[model samples]
Target: MNMPLELCEARDPKGLYKLARAGKIKGFTGIDDPYEPPINCEIELKQDNGICPTPTLMAGKVVTYLEDKGFLEC
Candidate 1:
């Protein structure tokens, strides 16, 4: 998934980002360390209008991508 750093920090449910920012955690991604995005991926999930898709919807997207690529074929 390709989400912005601001969004991730804003929606931080574990408060890890907050901790990282406060120097409580070391080498945290997007804080002290860099976050490298995938160079090449089969399916890239991104936010739509700054809104993340639900888990069910994200799963459906994965299934659809697999089906389109014939990965689900038996």
Candidate 2:
């Protein structure tokens, strides 16, 4: 739970979270169903001071690792 549900509500008073909570939405992540994260990931980027890393940067890091490890060449 990066930001708690209460915090989400606080951030967006008219968010769809209320509908999700009321079970009006089906198969919502972290609500009616558990979120299944990827396993055996090659790279896991840690948040920098609560700031998220850009997806492009993360992908570049993974590509660099793969290239260094001879898993990929491009």
Model 2 misplacement above 4 A: 1-25, 36-40
TM-score of 1: 0.76
lDDT at position 74, candidate 1: 46
Cα miss at 69, model 2 (Å)?
A: 2.2
**What is the C-alpha local distance difference test score of candidate 1?**
0.90
Local distance difference test, per candidate?
0.90, 0.69
TM-score of each: 0.76, 0.49
Clashes of each: 0, 0
Error of 1 at 7 (Å): 1.3
